[model samples]
Target: STEALSLLEASGYDYTNIELGKEWFLLGGEESVTRVALSKEVESGATSLPKIFVGGQCIGGCSELASLIDNGELDALMKKAGATKKGEPKKNTGFLSFLNL
Candidate 1:
């Protein structure tokens, strides 16, 4: 989650809503909610935490996030995801805002 934290920090995102991702287990438990949902959202053999989502879309973790930022696509995605302007503050509606179940 270190890499994920760095990426989010650089992007000016607060990690409070997503800390649940790290304290998770796949087994039956309350901690699994965020992790389980994130795992399913990512269409791959495996999904890792600090899964980045914008506009209710799973954008992958730190590496994928860096890729988007490098090509300036990150800004585009943020805009499409209803990101606010500078000084306007971005409100994270959290995992429920993206996934139905």
Candidate 2:
């Protein structure tokens, strides 16, 4: 989880970290079997630790995040999600900018 957090920090986009307790489940209501089913929904059939979600969609764990960074897609994803780098002001674009608000 620390490694994942490091990668995200280097990416410069703000992120939220939710450290689930050992007893917490990702999608399962309260049963282990349902947890297995949740993993299946992602087609991995196994949940990876330190899962990352962007724009409310799961993008897999640390390795996946690394891959996105390596391939330069992470920036695009963050931009699309309207995420700005920490300490940077968001640029108003399109209709909002035209309105001059």
> Which predicted model would earn the best TM-score?
2
Model 1 ranges off by over 4 Å: 13-16, 21-35, 89-101
Per-residue accuracy of model 2 over 18-70 as CA lDDT, tens digit each: 65554444344436553454466454655656667676556777888899999
- Per-residue error for 75 in candidate 1, Å, reads 0.7
Candidate 2 achieves a global lDDT of 0.62
Per-residue alpha-carbon lDDT of model 1 for 1-101, expressed as tens digits? 66656655576543334455334544444356665566666778244455666766677766887898788786677766667543566554342122121
Query: What TM-score against the true fold does each predicted structure earn?
Result: 0.63, 0.68
State the RMSD for candidate 1: 5.3
RMSD of each candidate? 5.3, 9.4
